[model samples]
Target: MDPVRTGGLRVVRAAVVLCVRAAPGTVALSFVMMFVGGVTPVGLAWSTKLLLDGITAGDPAGRNAGVAGLVVLGVLTALLSHVRRYCDQELSRRVKVRTQIELFTAVSAYQGLAEIEDSAFHDRLRIARDASEFAPVQIMSSLLTLASSVITLAGFGYTLLRASPWLAGLVLLSALPTLRAQIRLARRHGEMIVRASPFWRRQAFYAALLLDPRAAKEIRLFGLAGNLRTRMAREIHAGQAEERAQDRETLRVDLGLAAMTSVLSGAALAYLAARIAAGHGTAGDLVVLIAALAATQTALTSAVLDVATTGELITTFGHYIDLTSRARPQPRPVAELAALTGEIAFHDVWFRYAPGQEWVLRGLDLVIPRGRSVALVGENGAGKSTIVKLLCGFYAPVRGRITWDGVDLADIEPLELRRRIRATFQDFMTYELSAADNIEVGDIGGGRGRADLAAAADWAGIGETLAGLPRGYDTLLSRTFSDSAGDGGHEPTPGVVLSGGQWQRLALARAVLRTSADLLILDEPSSGLDVRAEHEIHRRLSELRRGRTSLLISHRLNTVRDADTIVVLRDGVVAERGDHAALMAAGGVYAGLFRLQAAGFADETVPR
Candidate 1:
């Protein structure tokens, strides 16, 4: 078998299995309905022929029986049509729900950012999402249609063959070209969609920018609306151009095939008319011949369409299969991971985001012992964030290893390793949820009560602020849903949006909620605060980090002055490490940077 055909068969098998598992009862009933519906047209044609013959012979009983059969079959056909539609809709809904769950689970359950950040991966993901919505359902529908068409074609073919063997052979042979053309067109359309995905993705990005609240101010201030709109329009036109070209080709091919079928049908009708004129056939035979020819053509056309459509859908669905079948990071066999009680050591570790790229960490060696605070100060792109990512097991070292106590990080399961650590990045998220949910998401599924949330908020110095909101902790923490109403008798009330400092405090509270975490990582925790807020937040942080195993990253030298040890990084390596006072006394990179920052606040009028 050809590879493409084999792959399509695999897709069909998988889709059938998925549909059956989603709604087995509905699927079985739908197949039964389709089988009955397929033969109804043949029965109607035969009844009409019987009525015509009986009318010519003056047979009253035969005419009445034919009329009754026609009435019963017509009504059954109508009812079955509607019932089958209902079954198909229900089956589609169930499959959509199941496939969507599986799709996102495969995406979210991945342990690293490497694939998620790749552009090619995102294209596949977008295609997979589209497949998730309709691919499996469509495959099942096309299969059912094909099955139904086969029955219709067989019944009509036999009738036509009995009436005139030559006409039956000609009609069946004429359908071969139509099937080949449809499959060829389907392959072209599938390829076009794959090529157009990047354009569609780019268009989605620009469209999102137009609606994003964060970009609204800058867009207006810079007069960027027109430029962004033009870019979005360009991408849309690019994708549509390909579709229009495909449509033109399809129209041309279909028109040519329709003309050929018309000519063949006309010739077949002439032959039958000549035979009847020769006294070899009756008016009843003419009616049956005409009906059989049309019915056979319709059934063959439908079967061809079903096969072509299934082929196209399977191509799109291949992306979903690829993503879901990808090899995920296997979990280590450790039943339970031990708490990080001793120390974490990074030994001669080297890493880069990609091969052949500049190394972000070059043979870097560091350690953080238990019950002590370590502060890392570095310039931009000096690998401060990279270290945090490596520590969290988001990526692995290209050379060397990181160990928790005596065990290598590579040996520990990523999820289990991360469970022992809590981190607050400089670019933390401000989730649009209720105040309580915003904080509680830190230790998700921990079942912590409101008291615990409030306590964590107090530790981050945001307890009073959250409690003072319109509905206290229950109040929404976003202006986006200000117009949305609450449950019960509560009417719409404007929700509040936190200021930068307040949002930062809320984020800290979130990190604080994970109190059971063994190692704490805080990256620029007070970067968004004002002078007074920063001072107050650091005061709270001092109490929080005291005698705790914590690694802090900050640019403000004054804030890290009280840390147990300060490490200054330059050129992907630790340049200096000591107490703040000792580093200042040494007059190295840390001392120079601290003096430059402190110089801005010097009292020129009094002290100078």
Candidate 2:
């Protein structure tokens, strides 16, 4: 099929399917109502002609019956109009909810993190989301409106043809220009929206920064609010300026079309008046001719506009289809992953986030032995977090392989592989959920009980802090909502926000909750804590790491001093590897960083 026809079929199929699934009875009834409503205008016009002829012929009974018929048709049309409006509103609501669910499901089904990291993907995803929000309703509405307008136009077209074929042809031809203009405008509008999506997203981000509580402190401290707001306003103005330019073109086209339509209607009206004045046509014929001409023009305009609008909606809906239909890499069929037994090894690994980008991990060889704590120490941009992502199966190496025991990671299902590993990253999310719920999310498959929750909290040294909250484990951990608001609506209560250290401890507690995982990775887990808190956390972590394979990534050298093995990374390659004592004795990159940090602490202790 032609691509345009294929896309149009897809849009129509989706609209029909959604309408029927959302509210089948309402959709059927809406069609009936709109059909009746469409034909009623011609019926009323004919009745009016009859009434005028009855008066002219001086027949009281004929006039009375015509009057009654016209009144009945008008009332029926109004009734159908109201019922159809109600049905459309209900259909729109249902379609909106259903589309949102499908869109979210499609987004969640994506298996790789690479697309999420790409700005172009973000732009497309944002447009898909926006399109899904209203495209279903717009498509259904436009389709139905087109159907009704076509019916109305056909009915009035026949009446005008019988009165004067020339006038009817002129009216039809005038609609051609309007239709062409509307279609062009619709294409331009869609293109502009796609081009402006990134700017709109940036504007939203800046606006969010002004409102975000986390950014509020920094924004005020640095006096960045004014600058950020100005940038946001500038983006909005730029977007508006683009829209205004499009609107100007649209205005010019519409005005020109309107002039043509006015000329056609005026010529039709003058011809009708001349026929009636010369006794060539009855006043009733003039009335009927005038009504048909006016209705034909109106219906043609509406049908053409509906076609243009539907075309635009179909184009937008194409984005949603494209996103949901994207091919994801299929995980190979393989045996279920077995529990880790010996070690996890990276052999000559080389990887980057995208093709042509600089390698984030290059020819890296490392081993994380079973039942041992291994620490990775590195400077910024040393691929520390990238290693964690690779280990967790978020990305596959562009070259080389990672293996658990003797089994290649590439052969293991990503989901199955993830089932045996857990990690907390430097940029861990603080979910706006209850304290217990946040911790529970870590090991949802484990069926963690109250004892397990408490044990995890205690291990992370956050039990005391959680116990003092307004609702203990059930306390809302975010200020986004009131405490009682999310707890089944018992009563409203103010939510409390945790301190930075407290939030980090909660994150640690979340990781600790996943007790069954064979490998536990902590990437800068204690970075947010104070000196005393960091010491206590590492001490607790040391106890937790006793017989489990774990990887620790941290800048603070002291925290990793007790690790069985320490690997220092530099420029995407392993620079050195040994126990803390051996690395320090070697006086390499690790030793230099340790000495620098030690010097800062030593100066602080000199009675400042």
TM-score for predicted model 2 compared with the true structure: 0.93
Over the stretch 276-370, how does candidate 2's per-residue lDDT look in tens digits? Answer: 89897778888888888889999999989988998787777777777765534466666587778899999999999888999999999999999
Candidate 1 residue-wise lDDT, 1-608, digit = tens: 12233377777888899999999999999899879878888888888878888899898887887898799999999899899889989998999999988888899778878878889878778887998789998888888988988898889899788878877888999989999999999989988888788889999999999988779999999999999999999999999998999999999999999999999988888888888889977787788778888888888989999999988988888778767766455768664678777999999999999999999998999999988999999899999999999999888999999999868998888888878888888999988888999999889988899999999999888899999998899888877677365577777877788988999999999998888888999999999998898999999888889999999999998989999999998888899999998999999999999999988878465755
The model with the greatest TM-score is 1
Deviation of model 2 at 369, angstroms? 2.9
Give candidate 1 misplaced runs (Cα > 4 Å). Answer: 1-6, 327-329, 482-485, 492-494, 603-608
lDDT of each: 0.88, 0.85
Judged by whole-model lDDT over C-alpha atoms, candidate 2 comes out at: 0.85
- For model 2, give the 10-residue run with minimal summed lDDT: 1-10
Give every collision pair in model 1.
none
